[model samples]
Target: MPGSITGTIVDPTGATVAGARVRISHRDQSAEQEALSGDDGQYSLPNVTPGPFQLTITLVGFTTQASSGILRSGENYTVPQIAMPLATAVTEVRVVPSRVEVAEDQIKAQEKQRVLGVVPNFYVSYDHHAVPLAPKQKFELAWKTTVDPVSFGVTGAIAGIQQAQNDFSGYGQGAQGYGKRFGASYANFLASTYIGGAILPSLLKQDPRYFYKGAGSKRSRVLYAIANSVICKGDNGHWQANYSSILGSLAAGGISNLYYPAKNRDGAELTFENTLIGISESAAVNLLQEFFIRKLTRNIPNYEPVSP
Candidate 1:
């Protein structure tokens, strides 16, 4: 059972083709052949030893073409040009977005984590590339902290402590005295935070948050925490002189003179002294944040794991 077999291949448009795989087979025995079509879509398997056979042609990105035929000894079988159909499309698409939009959404979610369910903890950003907040966002955070119920509770507690200690004696011992002290303390809180955390930070391009640098050696982390009292991250993410914290400290101290008992008022020298004290206090608090507060904070999200 031997004969010759031949075939050609074409595209759906029925034009001459090349670079196609042509295969032939019979039961239990087979001969494989391949040829590129001439420009006229002509091909042949001349003198091909044959029996009943199958032919398949294929090309990239096109449906394969196939046919069946029979051949007897010394016969030439020519298959019509096999036309291939187009393959289905494989579509791929991708999407990307601006970084600022992602950061803004993060900020919105962080605005909700209040300590004791009341004190605003809006300043921290877990994201390393947290876009520098706009001036509006700074003030908005300040406003949120000021209006929180815990702020009033803390103010009342401070006023009570001052009354018990009789610290502002000029405010006298009574409801009116307590009122004066409360107002003064509340005013102090407002001025310091708005000036340091919002207004001046916006003007000076300083970030007021204690950036948690939870990595590196303990000594380096300690130094970074302390240095932050006098240095701050700028919108550009570089360390810069912390004019906002310094000036806000001084401004808060200066404003205190206006509301305290006249005898308790600090002169300019005392104001500068108090400002230094405030800076020291900030360093201590930053160190605490670096080491302790994260443990105490109940609802903060995205906290990095601290090694034991």
Candidate 2:
């Protein structure tokens, strides 16, 4: 059934905000409608089909506000007066994050990302033009990733596989062997994540998160997925060599020699070869992120395109 939505727009200070863009969308349907607030800051979205709906309000210099609710059949739903928050700072070209605050918010949203509502996939960004993380935030993401229960479970599973296959025979067999393999596996994950995903990325001023390519042709996206393994976006928003990932892979592989069996420890040649393999695996994973993971991730924000 058809219904109507009406609301008044106000700034954080309670002043009426006129000329703000209001976008109303149906949650279960691919339908959207737009309206502009009037001089009195009042707007009406009449003849809206009843269902779950979301309303987004946008104005220059204000943080976007999103409101959602169920609209009953033939009912007029009057939402509370929408008061949009002011952006921390704004320039002629675009809005910049307020110091670390914006990045913190973005990070919080990213942290909630999980594949199929369980597996942690926090390193991918659904927003292509996301803000850069501050140094502290980078470490925070690494710590969070390392401490997640799922991460521990995965490491344990890898240890079980290795024990069953006797892949790392140096660790031997049985419960003690499983413990050794588990520790080694977790150490690898910790080192690589901190090095490639946090430490190096911080020092090099590069973003470690895989930016989702939701637009463009399939060929272009495939190229992007492959290229990201060797190239990354800097904090300045420019593309550059991905030394973080490359060097981190080498460093992690080299460090493993200290713990792995003598036979498994590769010389310099094998280290480089393993690094290359790691990069290849990263490309494959990024391709999955670009093409499939998002559909499985829960709690993803309805990210809109921002000016690059």
Candidate 3:
């Protein structure tokens, strides 16, 4: 005898789920019966053989469901309403800043850095893995250092001391002499800063900032600081000889000869001596930065220390 099977499909929220696929199969029968739930979420299979039957319901974006029951002879069997749960889905998203943008942010932090909350300490990066700066950013840093009020104050102090000692006697002592010394001192600062920290670094694709290595043995750190005077990290992040700083010192020293009193200028010999002195000064400053300056620097970002 043939019977019929009918059913309704719904979602977990108890709303009717139309267009769901409903299928019925009998163990004794080789053929399977299938129907799609209509707009009313109802499905029917008529003239099905009387036997134990299995019902399966499936819909897109929902889990498949199944039920089984026996059908009597010539009986119209109504299946209990089926509720399908939504399929689980996992999605991952990641947001990363561009290299230029990251470098800009780091520069902002560096600009805020000052030793003892007074002097600019903008050339040191606490973040060891910092992104390389673009040429514009290098120039910007140099300009900032040049125009800083503290820089002017420091230069004026040097001029005052030079006048007291009459070191450049060719200028003579007086307000006029003090003015000449101040202008000459500031010119040296400007020339060296732009030539070494900005122009040369940009041209050579080198990073001008010192990267602080906060993790290591004291001996290793000391060696690292001293080595930095002759070597630096390239834009590609590899260590290389620091031609920019070395050449910049020589260039600035050569330029000074143009303004310095003839007797004070020693030509190539003086330039080489100044360059060597500059290298020694850099090594000493690096040592101070590695061991003491960081403790006194204000507004430093709390970046993670590099691994040893």
Candidate 4:
């Protein structure tokens, strides 16, 4: 004959735990009986096969409980009240920014950088492992550079100097001449900046920033800086020939022939000459960036120096 089992469930605080599942099983028998604790925390398993049996109680948010006892045939067995403890709490957190987000933050930092708090120095990155900019970011940087108030002031100053020296004499003299010179100079600046820094970089998947190599011997640093003009880091983070800058210079120079005086336009000869001049200027500026510019640049991030 089968037996019966009864039990009550509670929490660690001795409060009755309703809805707790109670399972009774005998090792010697294939049958198992189950019940759920009522509102009063009481449970009863009827028709349980009598033998060595185990009772298990389980509920959400509480630890499972088990009890074992011996039962005789046709006997009514009552299990001791089960007290369940609260389950331990576990939580996990992750705070990683996406690559585009990281790059945007870095760009924000770079935009604040200026030489002596005056001239823009947005093209230099102190972090060697800086994230590559997306196409939109490249254009954003170029736009920021070209539209800055300082850029206009600098271009106007250059035009004034050219006028004083009677350079680009085709523009003639007076306010009209100065206006034309100013327009031409600003156009050149805009063309070179966008073509070299944004457009070609976006298409070619290259980095337009100068990566500062602050460590190593003076000669090695000089070589690194000079070599950077002809070669640059690709978006893949590998060193590659700087076709973007080289071709951009040529393209910008070619475009200049349209606005400059007819006599000054040397066609392909002028384009190649301007390209060479641009490269030379880049090399010189890179040398300055390596040796002296960082000290003068304000709002620089406290980035760790990268090894050559």
Off by over 4 Å in 3: 1-96
lDDT of 1 by residue, 112-191 (tens): 76656556667655443344676777787788878878889999999999999998798998999999999999999999
Report the C-alpha lDDT of model 3 over 44-156, residue by residue, as the tens digit. 99998765577878788988788887676577999999998897774323343556777899899999999999999999998776768989999999999999999999999
Candidates sorted by lDDT, best first = 3, 4, 2, 1
Off by over 4 Å in 2: 1-97, 305-308
Clashing pairs in 2: none
Better of 1 and 4 by TM-score: 4
The lDDT, on a scale of 0 to 1, for candidate 2 is 0.86
Flag regions of model 4 displaced more than 4 Å. Answer: 1-95
Q: Model 3: how far is 286 from its true place, Å?
A: 0.4
160: Cα error in model 4, Å: 0.9
Tens-place lDDT digits, model 2, residues 12-101: 789999999999975334469999999989999989876557888889888888777767657799989999788876532434335378
Q: CA lDDT of each candidate?
A: 0.74, 0.86, 0.87, 0.87
Model 4 Cα lDDT, one tens digit per residue, 1-308: 57788988989899998999998765434667789999999999888765457787888988777888756557788888889888777432335456688789999999999999999999999977577899999999999999999999999999999999989899998999999999999999989999999999999999999999888799999999999999999887779999989999988888888999987665797689878988899999999999999999999998756563
RMSD of 4: 21.1
